[model samples]
Target: MSQNDNNTDQKKSESHALVKSDENGHALTVKGKGRLLALTDSILKSAIASRKANQLAVDDSWMQEIWNWADSFTISEKKIPRNRQMLLGLTELDISGNLLEILPESIGNLTNLTELNLQQNMLSELPESIGNLTNLTKLNLQNNRLSELPESIGNLTNLTELSLRDNRLSELPESIGNLTNLTELSLRDNRLSELPESIGNLTNLTSLDIFGVRLSELPESIGNLTNLTELNLDYNNLSELPESIGQLNNLTRLDLSRNELSKLPESIGNLTNLIELDLSSNNNLSELPESIGNLTNLIVLDLSSNNKLSELPESIGNLTNLTELNLYNNRLNELPESISNLTNLIKLSLHGNKLSKLPENIGHLTNLTELDLWSHNLSELPESIGSLTNLTELNLGYNGLSELPESIGNLTNLTVLDLSNNELSKLPESIGNLTNLDSLSLHGNNLSELPESIGNLTNLIELFLSRNELSKLPESIGNLTNLIELFLSSNKLSELPESIGQLKNLTRLDLRNTMVRELPTSINQNRVKVIL
Candidate 1:
């Protein structure tokens, strides 16, 4: 028609115009035809109306939250909860995989809920509409079946993180001082008894685990939390403590081990940033608070099974950066040479004490590496304990020592040397110069013999000279060869030194009440087990 109808309408407007190809670039993955299929059908109808407006704003923020016990089989029902008032656009709710046992009353219409996760539920009681959430701030009722907990939960008042771990709560709601913006409060394995003075008003708690609760007392307003830093009342039933717990003062790890505490308040040395202090199995403690040497930033101090301690306060050598000092089953007979001022002690446990002697400044600690004076009542030892030399574990078992101080061959970094039930007849041939001895206990000793320099220990492995009074032994104790448990029981040793069949890692060879009636046919006798 006029230029062939405008050249066919300019080739149908260049086939719908949105073209590509400016060089070798070919991503015009031409799907439909020209004009880019009407601009890809108007951009797929505006991306389906922007994905239905983001799923209608996530279903209107989960239908204004609040009590949404979205079920999954948490134990069936107990009903009652329903969305009350416009639930203040409830904050977060999931009533956790439920089986509800109670806790409904429409949680007082979510007073602007903050965060409430009812973990694995089957709740046993709680809803006083949880005192209207009051803007809760993280409250997870972990593994529930709660055995009670609602003094209207002290009206939430902006909680800061409270998890009632594994519940069966025995009692708590002293209006938990109304949450007071808590900060990590877990009642581990609950059965809690007493703890209400409004939980000392939280005072901005900082980690407080009530492990295995049965708590006997603590409400001296727990010194108002004072910003705690790790406080676990382990195995509770506390016998005493309210010295306003030295007002917390930013404590750092305090586990009152198996409680029934026998005493401790010298204002507990005012915490002084304590670092791990566990009063192990309190056994009616016999005493211990010379202001705990003011905690000198303690580092692991566990007074093990307090067996009526008999001594230890020279301000316990002022701790001096103590590193693991557990006084096991005590009744101490001696030790405080101010423990030679600890000298950066490294694991020193005086097991079952009744000590006979030790303070020759016990070789000034020398950065000791595990030294347990087992059973104690020692008969001798202080040759300045052979200058520790970073000893690697040395337990002087059930003492009454017969002899040893040849400056124990300067401990050549001993590797476990437990001189079992002592009365040792003799040993210091410079203890075969240790050579990293690997476990050597002269069990119930009185050794009749054993020194060809014990064939230089050769990294001996578990060689306990059973109930000894040995009649004879040195063939260099058969060159150890990494022996494993070679106890010569009640020895009177009748015979058997064919180099004790050159032990090939003998696994237990106790010549019971020995007069060794036999054994030595190249002693493997089926991987040895000779208990007689």
Candidate 2:
């Protein structure tokens, strides 16, 4: 053989040594050989180091692809690529609000991740390999299309917070109970009909939100979560609660509003630690258990819109710590005298009820800032109302009151007062004593003339006296320099008060259907829009 032929043979031998083939005899390229050698070298180095080093040998091609995708992704004005480094060392990843539809199974290679947020995505399923992330402590998958979670998720025993809210999940895997360290879990706005019994295993849970789910009842196992401090089960189909619910004595806040519940379990009283309780909008609820009085620590209690609620248990007076009490739209005709014991109440709303009179001791609520008794059968108000010196807002509209008590002026702190649609023919001069008033509505009444004291409300921004029988406005009305809107429509006024020109801040003066035919030159010169 010639020298050239010998050189060619040597090169062929080198090439053959670098490449290999399968049993089928298809040759592997030199590039493939290089990759294989690199993988082998990594594995050998990992074996020589420690078990944790084995993770460093994982194929990083998948991560490289993810990095490439992240290059173009943005969330909340943050670029995900900015956090990237060597893939194996990644401990936290946030790709939320990216509209991502798939999560590659190779993601499990990121075993070092402790926090993963994929919320507000379109992902329909998670890879079972997710279980490989045993170090994960927080996982957020809210607002996704997930119909179910992989059982392997239970392997994340270190997880403390998991939010699967706004998903399509109808059921959870029993393995979920394995996450014993979980402290907060949110499944709000999902399609879940019931929770797995295994949920009780999460005794470390401090907060659990299952709002807007279709659950007709909660599992008895839920009672096992004695450490829970906040539990929200609003907007469900629950008609009754399991007695086991009383076991969660640590709960500080409980929301059971907008459900089909007709009665609450008497055991509910056991949650004495509760600071807020909402049981509103349960149309079937006619009476509350006397045990409700046991929640003495409550600061807010909402029992509104229960149409059949005709009376409250006198025990309600036991919640003296309450600051807000909403009992609007009920069938109650009279309030229990015990209600006066809620001396700490700041807001009391009883509108849309059949109440004809208020307790004479209502003045006991010295801290009251707002009182609403609209749409009731009240023909008169108790003189004791004058004692609510701290009152800022008072609504007695749509009542049968023919006159206000002369002591009404005692509410000097009043900023808004609505007494519309009443039988009042005249307002007490005391009405003017509310000098702090910014808005006063007295329309839809039988008033024939103005109270000169009305002019004393110099702070008034809006004065509504429409749909009344007023024949003339007091000249003192011009003293309201801060008035922005003056509604005098459907009244018998024949002409504008020359003092009206003094309202420099007036923007709208509605005089439609009034006897006035000409505009005040002062109003014509200003920017006021007069609606005739």
Candidate 3:
């Protein structure tokens, strides 16, 4: 018989045998928990030795020590688990945070145990006999020094959730494939560079996490996990995915962020059930598959930090159900007119891109409530944008816009508007129509004056107009009775506007390094902190 055959049979024998000791100085076999506890070590060892070929049990002393430990089981809450067999039939044990270094091999005596938690330990290895716990349904060995797993781990075929997160495991044993019933497995923050092809055998797996590994590629066999609903492979060195990945039709959420992937297989579009897909920080990704539009069920798509991407496919417009799309930190120079098809979009992030213009019909997304276009090269906004009556926040900072369309004041629902760091030299008197505006930022521009209409923002709470060419603040600024913080430093101001004292809610006022020569007497009665 092969050595492998011997080991297999050995495991089989131990599971069925009931041990005991006889009077002949030789151990005997008897059933039941019959206080076999009193059996002498030499007697038990002798009996174990007489057994035929299979190496059934370990040293008698070792077995006794395990039985003793089992009898010692008690919860640290200074209480025992409230089970009828609290002392004899422990089905669950959590000795986590105990700082144990070496787990005894005799732990396998727990044949009836269903759960074992040894998380947060300094243990560097698990005893080979650990596999004898055939009934274990959950095991948490996270945050340990386990550099390797025992091959017998395959014996715990009933484990549904196994977490080895934050461990030192460099690779999983090929025998892990025997756990066909596992549903969730976490190997995050490990040194694993590759997974065994046998992992594909986990057809029942629903979630698999391998984030923070050094894996550069996925095994092609990974596609066999058709029942998976969520998969996280973020922060790995993966530069490509297997074409077979499209087989995960049940997958609803997938994260492949922070990898080296330059392109994705077109098969990715086959995940019609995918609702959320994050491909952020893949620096080499230059474009997405045109088939990406096939994800009509998608609600969120994040492609941020892929700076090499210069454009998106027109087919992207097909994600009509998408509520959020993040394209931050890319090199996109133009937007597809098809974006108008995403009328359900609520939040759109396009910051740090090279976009010179926006889709003229972007207002078609009237459902949008937040729009982030900061740090782009946009010189102007299309007048059609005002059609987004639901917009509450608009960010156009660090752009080269010379002016805003007068239609901007039409977004009466806007609460936060940022137009700082632009080339604007003037504001249309119609700007004051934003009566619902709560905060406005227009600093670092060429504006020499404010339209008296600025007072129309009756709800304005915070206002920033620093570092501009402003020679004076519009008296309407004092009408912002809800103001709390006002920054107006480094401007060409010559004197304080008496209306400023009318700001009853203003708490902080900055006026350093400006041309202001004097203060209005009302400023004293208003108790405003003056920074001359």
Candidate 4:
């Protein structure tokens, strides 16, 4: 009886296993059992396939040859693939703006890399292995905290362009001269106090920027780069240039501004091909070499802010091709008549000088577009000034100008005219002929009234008449419909002309300390800010 009961129970258990129940405890049919078995097999196959695909991806990731981790990539050695073939095939790697504080030494394994950009990072030092990138033609390490470079950096002989700007580097490795193929090198805004004499070995260099360095002198070997066309040595402490600099006959532009240079080497005149030269802000520069006249090709020359520069070489006239000449803030009392020979001059600035008069032939520069003679002792301008019909901007403020030449009316193209802080008791009626003037400054003057013809300046957007003796404004003042700013502060104006209300575009009306006690009802107080 026990054997029979055991066999029956085993059979019942098998049957129950083949059936399934719904939430309500239901039994399954044969077809349903078959369907369930097929579904389970399909799920197992998908799981196995997905696992294989994931494994394949992991295996192939190491074959990637290009890596661009700009900004979004996190620095982690474990995340980089370690395959040798992948490293050898990688030709470009950019990790700019990644805030990377440290680069892995293993990066040198990418021996085939031609371009590497690590700009805008926090890196203070580079691995010595960096020199191993002999195939690299371009490398940018700008805006980093590096104070020095590995001497092995000179090993990158193939480098043509390298930027180390905005770093703390105080000196460069002499081995850097090994990059004979370098055409462009930038070391701007670094702490470098001197350049290695070996730098002259880079004869192929055409552009070299060493701006904002502390260099007091350049090596004579620099002249060996006869192929150089541009050299920027601005904001340095250089007091003099090596005479050998004249050997760079190919130079088209040279900047020695903001230095302590007291004089220039006569050999500098040998650079006959120079097109632009800047020597501004050199407080100790007292004179220029007479040989400077040899630069017949010079088009732009800036000698501004050199307080000790009392005179210019007479040979300056040889630069007939000069288009711009800036001599602002010097001690020159007069200009050489030869200056008038520069018919190509487009801009001439002589402001903040002791010049009592300009060359009588200054008017010959008909091509002049801008002339700044402000802050000078000039009491009168040559009538020839009016001959500069092409002039659009003229500054004569902070001067002893008691009168203007009648010929000034001929400058029909003038858009800006500044005559403030002068002894002008009256303005010539011809001043009204400057119909294109957009700004007219007459503040700090003795004008008690404006000429009625002033209304002819319909394009006037700004009119400065503060600190003047203007007791009344002409009715024509309202004719300046485009005027947005009217300065009448510290004036003797006791009342406003009803025509003043015609200035529909006026937004600012300065009347502080004026005699006026109230505004005219015609004025739109809501739109105009009246300063009392």
Q: Which candidate achieves the best TM-score against the true structure?
A: 2
| lDDT for each residue of candidate 4 in 238-283, tens digit (9 for 90 to 100) | 9999999999999999999999999999999999999999999999
What are the per-residue Cα lDDT tens digits for candidate 1 across 228-345?
Answer: 8999998988899999989897988999999888888889898889888899888888978788998899888988888787887899788799878988787878877788887888
Superposition error at 25 for model 1 (Å): 63
lDDT of 2 by residue, 380-497 (tens): 9999999999999999999999999998999999999999999999999998899999999999999999888889999999999999999998989999999999999999989988
Which residue pairs collide, candidate 4? Answer: none
lDDT score of model 4?
Answer: 0.90
What is the model-wide C-alpha lDDT for candidate 3?
A: 0.88
lDDT, model 4, position 504: 99
The digit string of per-residue lDDT tens for model 3 on 18-116 reads 654456566566533333455456556866777732433344455556545544443253322323345237788888886777777767866778988
Q: How much does each candidate deviate from the true structure in C-alpha RMSD?
A: 22.3, 8.9, 12.0, 14.4
Model 2 CA deviation exceeding 4 Å by range:
1-85
Report how far residue 203 has shifted in candidate 2, in Å: 0.3
The superposed Cα distance between candidate 3 and the true structure at residue 329, in angstroms, equals 0.3
Estimate every model's Cα lDDT from 0 to 1.
0.80, 0.91, 0.88, 0.90
- For candidate 1, what is the lDDT? 0.80
TM-scores for candidates 1 onward, in order: 0.34, 0.87, 0.86, 0.84
lDDT of 2 at 75: 39
